[model samples]
Target: MTRMSSFRMSAWGWLAFALVPLIPLPSVAEGAAAAPVLQGETCSVPGLMDQIRRGLASKSPAYQRYLRALLREAAVTLPGAELQAAFERETDPVMAEHLAAALVARSEREADREAMQVVAKRALEDRDPAVRSATVRAMRRTGALEKTGDLYERLMRDASPEVRMEAATNLVEDNKFVYAGQHGPATDTAVAAAAASSDPKATAKILGTLNTEKLGAEAAGTLQGLLRSDSAEVRRSAALALGGVPAEQMGTAREALVSLYRGERDTGVRKALVQGIAQLGFASAVPELQRLKGIDPGMAPEIDAWIRALETGLQEWELILREKQRLQQAP
Candidate 1:
């Protein structure tokens, strides 16, 4: 017989294998097998409250786990009272984190200012970084961060990078509150710290905010320096921000973008620099773009297109300016 045939099970062994399925297995808990299906029903307030209560009251670890899963599934429909009650009753750090996450999800779907405030307070006081991060995320979703500039500024300095990043991003999103009267000093301080942060993501986010808020000229020098950052993302963000610099500052911005482009080796960063240069629409950049075109065979096509676009844009701008001047000089 072949080696494989010799190793195969005999008829009696095969018969035993076939009969194994007929043997009775141990019974599972009464509702354990159906827990997942039952959990889906918890989307109603009463159903969710029942799950929360059972999750809190259960002594069996498996039952508690199933109930918690149910609460998580029904979190979006959970009312403020149940979420608050769950938050108060949960003592396990892990379970507390889950409850906090659930609160965030619920707050996101419904504009529950009071519930969001309660969670925000908890997040501020929580000893756990994960919980704090989750709360910040919740606050972000509810637009609560718009008026909590100071809290976000404090969180920006948190030891947890995740929390700090969350705070940084929220601050940028709600920058109007940060720059508003009386809060301007604190907001500027936070922004300055973010600009100088070692965290590239934080720096990139701030740069993007500056661009979006049309404050690029206000931070022109900082943006220019960030183009040399080790993080390609930050450099790209800086390049895009430079493109938004005010017309009066276009001279310095154009020069900086071209210089960075000439020395940049990263294709992505180079493309961003070209876009910035093209956006600035400086007639002087045409020669620089032509010069850089020969350095990279792959980039030549893109660079040529930018040059053509820039030339067209500059001509249109000149025509508009001349028309304005002629109209001003006319009777």
Candidate 2:
């Protein structure tokens, strides 16, 4: 047998190939056969966003609105009145309130008055702390943040501890201004050092400190050295740390990533490479990704999706560049 066929015949390989192509292969049975699919909205699967959208847009009122809001946010909006009712029936006050706001955003025109009335009702009276929290979020989304500020303040002082906590968290989160100096110059200095530090461990520690712009220039400069780290742990950390590195450095990082992918046989390192590539969103890595496809076809869909998104982005960049050149020449 060929290498691919040989690999496919291994225990894990047999299991991987024996299962359904579209649906996930069954997990290894330890004792009894799995339970029958007598399901009504089972969340056992990982990628149920599409399934939930379809189910929610149906006759189940309570489930419909809840599913709609969830699906809508995922870029797969469900339709119908059931979703609206589902939003209302949500026991979690915060969630109900969120559904209320989400509905308002999705709805349109004076024709949606009746639906708006339901949202308004939830905003007015929902005992669940989560419902109340969702209501505040909805109001803000509707540009009624100022109008709802008084209500949010009341929630902050609510009798329910959950309500108070949600209110406080949202208050801090929505404002953004409050978190300004929480980590200032010292944090920035540490991040700068980590990005350029010669010691891989030191670099990893510094990279860990930064949540933002710490990855750009320093990541580009450190790319070659990081890929050559003597310590596997440091190399793995460096790979992860390169996530969110500047787009301009994507080409350079791509080479290091491929090297890491090949040289580092560790599963953790492989996963890190996958995640970092996803973060960098680089198109130049398409050829490399295509090469990796031969090694593991199971991840083909994800790899293809990444390649498409990157290529589309690169195409748009090219168009922008062309337009810039056109403008520059016109003068």
Candidate 3:
């Protein structure tokens, strides 16, 4: 499927790492009302909270959700004193500000980290394939590469091509070494060829030097076609590649993707449908995706999730419909 460029640095290798933990954990006053929670020991809730708070302060949406989940956990296990200690000891000034703001908004930090972990783990191990696919996506985004590589490799060899397809797609995107021809030789093919090549590095170097612009339009159209391909691998790659299209030409591929979502029977293709729709911000497809639930109710929760993301996902659709009406009424 589509290739993506991944960050060269580790997730923890951020500016916050330099600033936040560098500050010493604050000591309690001689007559403090209560002692700290797990003083001198590794407390998971605080560590998790710090990670999430730093993420939220950086305005990282991915981390914001992660932090929200962690805050939920803190509300459950940590007393206000413990939270205050962790918050007071935060080294990063910017993060400290955000932590203060969030404290004002929330009444109780109510999250069940243990329960969430169990759900995430079970999803990874679920017999229901769709649940597993969703879990894998969530894990990858949240930087939970703990055992993801091994799990992905195993899934690649699974009897169900669907599972293998989703895992491969996620891995390919996460690795950032895969590229579609739009940017030159597709990374998927290059990775495959390199694995079989005598000199994978040289092949990769050659791939790096290719003229990506040469294949631009062809790559866009190819991505559109691949989204509808019966082969799961092709669909996954296409979905990933679709993300790489130049913004100017994104509109060019809209009609083709809309048609695929309406007619394609493959679940992998439909999954790609959600991605492409989000990327292009094709609000017109909202009604179509909404109707698709009649064809398949299982997509309801996901549709609701996507819709709830930005002011209930309604403003965008309403704006699009209003623009259409304006165009229709114009001369």
Candidate 4:
């Protein structure tokens, strides 16, 4: 129902939307809910597990009641294993709103990637769109978005419109910090500093931003340097950034990329670099790609696709651009 083709806010527009004042909700008092009769008879993990074990044994409402209390209190995280076990045993179908939400909420607060991943997997396969939507929002709240990006992207095409919309919103909002840049020396310095200090993967996100005269040159130069970085993530980002650079730099960019790919060893980075070549490199790079494919027959299929993409894609792009220019001149 949710269409991935729906108009998305630009990076700056997303930023502006984010600038709205948010009202902070009141925190739950720890003593708001009486501690469940857990092991050690308290709110600790062992205590919670004891309660869970007892409840699971009896298949009673005690464990479920304990979980509901934990959800209401919102101060502590239930162990993922115990929480999941409780979720599976819930006779009532409200676990999506209660148990799964608790799991994701606690995981987001704890920065627990494993627990978050559990929710992500569930969201993708969950029968209920509401559950899937909540899980997508939780993914947006975690620092684990970089690792779980593929999963989120897959969810953007979810059959449920609500789930797809949630996934799409998160994808746009999550990348705001990276793509929201204007052409200026200050922007250049900020980007350079971020690239140097932050995780290469984070810098990689910025590489996908649209380029301008000043930023394009700076980014092109920075990307070339990153292409040879020790971190494959940096190299991968640099390769992907190839498509957005100024026209004048494409020739040299492709040449340098081809040279880098010749000696590249990381399979993932190699694929990224090949994709980069398809974006910016010319037919001249094909022989080397074919030669490399022969050297690594395992990659022959991938290389053939890249060669086809390079041959076909750019020609089509050129025609499109020419048509656009002609239309502009016609007026």
Point to the candidate with the largest TM-score. Answer: 1
Q: Write the per-residue lDDT of candidate 2 for residues 1-331, one digit (tens) a residue.
A: 8874454245233223323244343566733666444323322112333345456457778766555444334211334365576676666543455456556655432334455556545654676656665665564323232323244434444555554444434433333342331333222333333433344444454343233333446534554466566656556666765654555766677667776776566666666676566555556556767787666555565566555556555444335335434543554
Q: After best superposition, candidate 1 residue 49: deviation in angstroms?
A: 7.0
Q: What's the lDDT for residue 56 in model 4?
A: 48
What residue runs in model 1 are displaced by over 4 Å at the alpha carbon? 1-125, 141-146, 150-157, 168-196, 205-213, 216-218, 282-288, 294-298, 311-331
* Residue-by-residue lDDT tens digits, candidate 3, 156-259: 44454454555545444444432323324343332332222223222223232322233356545644654554455455545544543566656766566666
**Whole-model Cα lDDT of every candidate shown, in order:** 0.62, 0.50, 0.45, 0.56
The digit string of per-residue lDDT tens for model 1 on 175-282 reads 545343234333344445466567777767765544332443455676677877899988987887677566777888889988887788899888888878766765
Tens-digit per-residue lDDT, 1-331, candidate 4: 2331121123223323333445444447755755543222224434443433445455668756545444523323346677666644443334444555566656656645466667678778877677777656655533434445457546645777676656545543444443343333433443353355334544555454424324556656776777888888778867866644567888778777878887888888888787666655456557767877865566777777656655543555445335434543553
TM for every model, in the order presented, reads 0.51, 0.31, 0.32, 0.39
Point to the candidate with the largest lDDT: 1
Span of 10 residues, lowest total lDDT, candidate 3: 1-10
Ranking 2 against 3 by lDDT, winner: 2
- Off-target runs (Cα >4 Å) in candidate 4 are 1-194, 208-215, 282-285, 311-331
Note the clash tally of each candidate: 0, 12, 11, 3
From the highest lDDT down, the ranking of the candidates is 1, 4, 2, 3
Worst 10 residues of 1 by lDDT: 34-43
